[model samples]
Target: MSTIQFTFAVFLLMTCSSRVHSQICEAGWFGSKCQFQCHCTSPCHSITGQCQGKSTCLKGWFGNACQYRDLAHVSSCNIVLNPRQPFSSWVTDRNDSTCNEDVTLESVALSWSTSVPFTWMRLTLNESVILRSLRVSFTSKTSSNATCIDTKLYLINNKTVDIRCKVIVDTTSVIIEGQGVKSLCSLYINGGRNVALKQNSAQTSTYTSPTVAASASKAVDGNTLGLLSSNTCMRTQSSDTCPNWNVTFDQSQVLTAIHIYNTNDAFPVCSGRCGLQLNKFSLESFNSSGTVFRYQDHSTTFTSLYEVTVAEMASGIPVNGLRLGLNRTNPILMMCEVEAYGECVPGSWGLECKKICADRCSSQCHVETGSCPVCNDFDDRSSCHTGCATGYFGYDCSQPCSQNCQNRECNSTTGLCFSCVDGYLGPDCPENVTENIEDHLLILITGLGVGLGVSCAVIASLLIVIIYLIGRGKQPLKESKPSPDYIQRDSIGTGTMDSHGYQIYVTPVRPYQNVSNTYIKVIGDAEVIQPPDTYINVTTKANDEHDDC
Candidate 1:
């Protein structure tokens, strides 16, 4: 007993120590003992070692554990289209075991559109999904006939029927027309897990024989035998009439694509044996609103798969229910499985809900995409991520922040400035104003005094120059009289000479008082040579007097 007690005590201590170690390791480390380390630079969950936060996980690591090195990433949105995931129709009698082609309805067959003549079954889904590719599993049955390929398959969404055979034809599958998104495929269907659904017809020509009825459910049942059940089985009815249904959803679901499964590969003859397998039948959806409206009216010959899932368009309204139509009288409208695809998640929206919605979206967003069709007061138009534009903050981005905030920008929700621009401080950014009138006044006075001094100096200089000029003008010029010998030399007659260093006298100078000075001074020596035919003047005047010569 003593040994057992000691052993138990040791075990308890070991267990407690292990638990503490697991809780004590930092985010980046992981191990049984919390002694091992993870290489991811981002902080991970202590036990799981998964990096988290707004930023993505470190490169070379992925997944919740950050343990994968592969580049493959998983999508959070549900994009695959599976008919067995709890889909409901407006008028279903029994939810048969239709997940595979081998399953069948035991006692009840959900029939629709008999009284109203509309072949459509109001459909609803469990989750909102942007429809991807749809692969309908047809009920499988063996048949010796070869006329089963004549049946046509199609999809009608809210009174609009897509008939582009290239998009989705035959009794199998459909891709949305115009691409992956041609209309708003968002649907609000019943919540939680979906129940199995199968549509029934009111026609009396249904192959009542057990041989024909035994394989009817094989088209929708997921059978491992493949084409054996698909080649001969078809849900048949005598008359192709109205299946008026109003499918209401407990939750909102988005739909973008539709896929129908019929036993097209069946070799059985197409003489009403296969109700869903018909040569010419139309799939239609009834419009609950509006008296006059137009919808998809395109048509084409069907092949094997009728896929209508490739377009980028939006529906005018989020579809509440759909209708099915057949043009031929007493035509068989048989089907094994039906699949609906769309993007109508509550938190998300869009064709596939591929685009994420803004955080501040108030209510329903764009049904075909996750973009916010409407936002809160301060929310952004594209995304409600930011409450308001710059310089505005607080609830709904209604309150104004300080303009002095650095770069004139501030937090979108809070008005506090990271820093002021200039001349302000504190949370409210008060102005840095002060009085400096006294200093400015002193500077102005000094400038005025300097200007006055300069003006006085200029005036004094101008007055002195004026006084000097006036006084000098009053003085008279002093002149000396020429000598009698100089007058005798000048009285001699001047002669004209030609060329070679000789002077020519046009007329001798005659003296006059106050004459203009225009005399040419002679260079070198001057000599008197009397010549005939030359004129000379005898009167002379001094240069000191104003004289002309």
Candidate 2:
């Protein structure tokens, strides 16, 4: 009992206590006491039970601790499995949804003489399941040299995963083909489930009945029994207006399909139970961001389940709520069950919602593919990512520009033309100004021609009148000579008369005032002419009063 012996004993005791406190559990289990099971899409942390890397918890489970579970999980244990080829002895009852302990398939050894493409033992699941990863054990009963076996995973989402050994799995079923191996055994899945199971659900009105429980939550209770005795169907209150049923998930989810189990009660079999009232109903999805996405109308009458697939997830918004109602006011609405299958995590897409979207993706990425939804303009509807081509504009580039547009070019968003050709005007280049201008010119020319014709006619009439008056005034005067007594001649030095003056004759002028100034002496038919010096251009009367001597 020395100081050294006591100190060593205390240290050894402390080491044993620490080792007992932190005992390790197997791969899929974690907790302070190593008691909780993990269902992460990726590997879970040993201490905290959280999903590691960039992965998330499987659908129906959430939170940092991954302890909270929702109703979205649908187990594949009891689902039926059928082989693609009938009468194949390879498949048996052991090939059910639950992977058996000793189930295995045997294949022949690889050789050129053997069948070229080996046959695959394909099994189709009666119900689809969302899958993350799958593992299958392989063994050889004989000497086989193949190190790897090929496996194919087919999803109900129309996607395929082909890989070697343990890899990414899919929904619905798996197809297996052995290489040079002899046997393949037991299947194992990591993660996948439904997101809308047992979530908060409501309807416009519940049926007022004392004998039955017909609340809206009955539609999503994972029960498809349509009988009235089962009491699993949801019945709305009878009214003249259409009734609506909605289910809201705790978190946003990207959905693939929504299955509605129509009412099929047998006791008092009515038209509603036969899915007559289920026809002509529409489905709408509400996103967490307050956006509602609508689907086309459903008109088919089914005896059992009717599936509606929401294909376009390009809007990028994760759905939080779903609404299903009749298009017409059919009095009452009765639904046996409703199931929604999809990924519950946002900002992630693709198989199992395991892939993260790119940073450049705006709003939301497509659920199947990580590609962003772009090309809102008309030019590129199929990922062209360009503006609308010439002569096309508006959404989807379906609208054509006006033919009068110059070079057939216009705004890609709006149909407004850049410029009008020739005489066309306005934004759409629909108005023609050339025709108006031509019409005005024709009117002006006609007016000018009429005015010129009238002016010419008036001028010609005035000239004709002037000519007639001049001719009437110029008519020859009556021939009358002065009387013989008036003729007197004198030979004076003053030269008043001609030198030889036997007789003098004077002629009168009329109209135009020009007088004859010639003096002639007549003696027995002989006439005498006046000298040049005595000749004068007279402008006076023809009578004697005009004479100046």
Candidate 3:
């Protein structure tokens, strides 16, 4: 190195070394760079920079410095149960989980027409949610009419709570169960905000299916019962291969128990013949990924339902779907329902969470499988904190029960049709008219048939009588009259045989006995002549055989 450059380099090194030794961390802060915040009640040690008394970093912040960073938010006990998260792969919640939505509370109430104006409204949330507060609003005319509003909460860990408050009018703020909860799934509000809201309750449901076999089903459709029994219950395929039923869920669960319902009243005889009544079957549960857990069962009681506890779970294995198989499907391998108890699927609430709930439902139904961890009855899958009220029916609960219906109430599913009016039929109840032309026409047709049959019988008898009269007229009757003059002429007659085996009669004439005036005489069928009456005897012969007879 050059002489001047070397001297400058040494000076720089000495200055940097001195500054490094003199620098020290601030109070409540420690680290080589002096950036860490400590969790100390008092000042930290000067050399080691350790907290003097209390624990390091109050729940959130870490390191030696009291940085006021929230570590608790990061280390919070919220274990994400949704395996489909990071939200990219899911339909809901691509953004953060906190979705603050403003919704119209008008549609969620259970409503039906009544003879009396019994106006009430209700609202239920979809999934269990941590409640911040509730905001209510009313119009000038409605606030005076509403009676009360009720609320229900379903915690994610399977707990339920209720709260009710009288409507004090205007927009009132209320707290539901008053606490932060473990993934709350549902909320509810009853009684209308206004009286103008007179309409039928909507019962809506949404399904987040995973390649369901609706189109792939062989027989016995995939409606209400298809989810439980993937196989055709009453029918068998040509090949006797054991049909396997499979179901896939949206997330994984730690399975503890299972329930299987066989083909019930549907095609009872065919179910028996087709092996719809299960004898020997095997079940396999799969995780969110395709890993599996297996079990086997054999019974002969012909039960419609079967419940079994999982033998291989202390803490339980994560499961998302199940595979049911049969050893021999003489008729068919069939089931009516399949239920698994495990960690609840996300976007679902209440018990085992098999219900299809969505914002479309105006009312929700309480599920009866397990203690609700999060959502309440019929949660709205479309809206996390939105769902139909209880006892409402239809997609948006837009159709109401009949005004004449009892209590103005109807089934949430079947609606008023379940207990329809006296003269009504169908789900929508098109009126039944009293005077029916079809009945009259049927009666007329029957009368015509009877008249035609009677006429045919009478005509046949007349034809038979006419035919007898005509045939009798064509025949002649015979009557014999004896010839009066022939009896006095014959003296004696003799019979002779002819070639035709006919009898001929002969008569003898004596010459002295009678001589005609001219010595000639004619008889009936013969001519006789004698010569001059000179002792002549002549024999007369008959022209026809009748003369001999």
Candidate 4:
């Protein structure tokens, strides 16, 4: 090989090695080989394939690997429509699987106004969501044809879509319109779960006889059969003055509307009046506090409506129970089925209550819309989070922090200062609690003086007791045996000597009486004057082996 060829070969090898070593995957790609697609809401780690950023997987995706998808959540959605046409608002009502294409007595349908050939309905969502598929069951003006010919969905980015068409796009709002759309029998966006399915139910009185019985729970049994003989409808006893029925949800629910399927008893015995008897009734909702809010009035006369829809109050009322009862008069009330559809309780939103409310919301949020009724601050109207800045506090952050607060820092929710300045006290730091330092020192000195006086009194009492004991004279000393060669002295001693110059005394040991071990000796000078009461003399001869004193 030539020199130039060898150098070129080495450089090419190094370049290839560098490129291979720095092989980085794109944003959506993960795994060691970068062959797997990330299903996270943000991005995933390139090597471990774990969700990054918030570490949360995308909607409907779960598990540590984010490989499994919850089809039930991915396919469920609630429609929020802003009607631009004169059509009734019933078009946005949620329907269950029991509803079919045909407009039956139990199927609620929205009829399009024939005055407008083209109609548009704009959908508004609380947050941006992935668009799945739109399901609209359009009925025909005639028996053999479909009226909705040019049904188109307008995406946020000005993209057009067809009915029931697959769409994977992030959108906050969309417009839906159809050319020559005669009537909408049923409308479903993706799919939604019936939160009121098989919930607890009760009525004022149940119709009971020897052959059959109808309870309040029958209305929520997911059966739309309206026949009286089917035993699936709920009926109140005829004797009850005010027939009433209610379904209490296990958890609190924020309902937008409720669909009531009236019993359509088509029998020869009852002339066309079975379904008509359900008229002149009202639909009401109540919470645990017994606060009732009527959603539908008793004046409604559904001449041909076997399926009645009661729209809830604005902002989606949070309720635990729904009531259906006669108003102003006693009438028989019977319903085959009832479905209350909306988002779950507060603190949660979205399908199956999987989405959490924004942490900024000081109070609960609107169930479907995720709007906070009470935001933490006022600066950011779009969000409940973003609490008040350094010097601001209170609702919407309108109020300023207290002047007494140190550094002007206070609680955003309560508008109270976290800590007060030197002299101020309390949450708002409004009360002045400062006192003079000299007064405090005076109190300390007084306390110390009292303590010293008490200690001196105790010491004086102890000294008196000691002096009295000493004046009573000393007690006798304890005696102990001494060695033969040593003299033992008693511990009790009087510090006084006799008038005599010297005195000597000897005493024999009483315990040692054996003649071999006993001896005594004493010497006093004849010149020394000895007091007879204080002196004693003794002599002993060792050879005699006897001693006396």
Report the number of the highest-TM-score candidate.
Answer: 2
Candidates' C-alpha lDDT: 0.34, 0.49, 0.36, 0.48
Model 4 C-alpha lDDT per residue in residues 88-112, reported as the tens digit of each score: 3344322211222222222222332
> What 10-residue stretch in candidate 3 is worst by lDDT?
194-203
Q: How does model 2 fare in lDDT?
A: 0.49
Candidates in descending TM-score order:
2, 4, 1, 3
The predicted structure with the larger TM-score, 1 or 3, is 1
State the lDDT at 164 in candidate 2: 20
Please give the ranking of all candidate structures by lDDT, highest first, separated by commas. 2, 4, 3, 1
Error of 1 at 312 (Å): 10
lDDT at 274 for candidate 1? 44
- Stretches of candidate 3 exceeding 4 Å from the true structure: 1-236, 265-277, 288-291, 312-315, 329-331, 345-549
Once fitted onto the true fold, the runs of candidate 4 whose alpha carbons sit more than 4 angstroms away are 1-193, 209-211, 266-272, 295-313, 328-330, 350-549
Of 1 and 3, the candidate ahead on lDDT is: 3
- Collision count of model 1: 88
Comparing 2 with 4 on TM-score, the higher-scoring candidate is 2
Taking all chains together, each candidate's TM-score versus the true structure is: 0.28, 0.35, 0.24, 0.35
Go through the candidates in order and give the C-alpha RMSD of each one to the true structure: 41.2, 46.1, 48.6, 43.1
lDDT of 3 by residue, 1-549 (tens): 999999999999999998786567666544444433345556775445566664443433322133322211222212222122332111111112343232322111111121111111112333432123222222222232232233323332212233222222222222112112223333222221110011111111111225322221222121225332343222233244545566555444444455665655444435433334466676666553443556656566566556554442222234556666555534355554455544333233332244544443223322222222222223343233544354454333434555644455654433433444554444344544233335555666665565555556656655675576568884432232323432221111122223323332233221122212121110012122211212111112212221221
Give candidate 2's error at residue 290 in angstroms.
Answer: 4.3
Q: Show pairs that collide, candidate 2.
A: 72-194, 316-364, 379-388
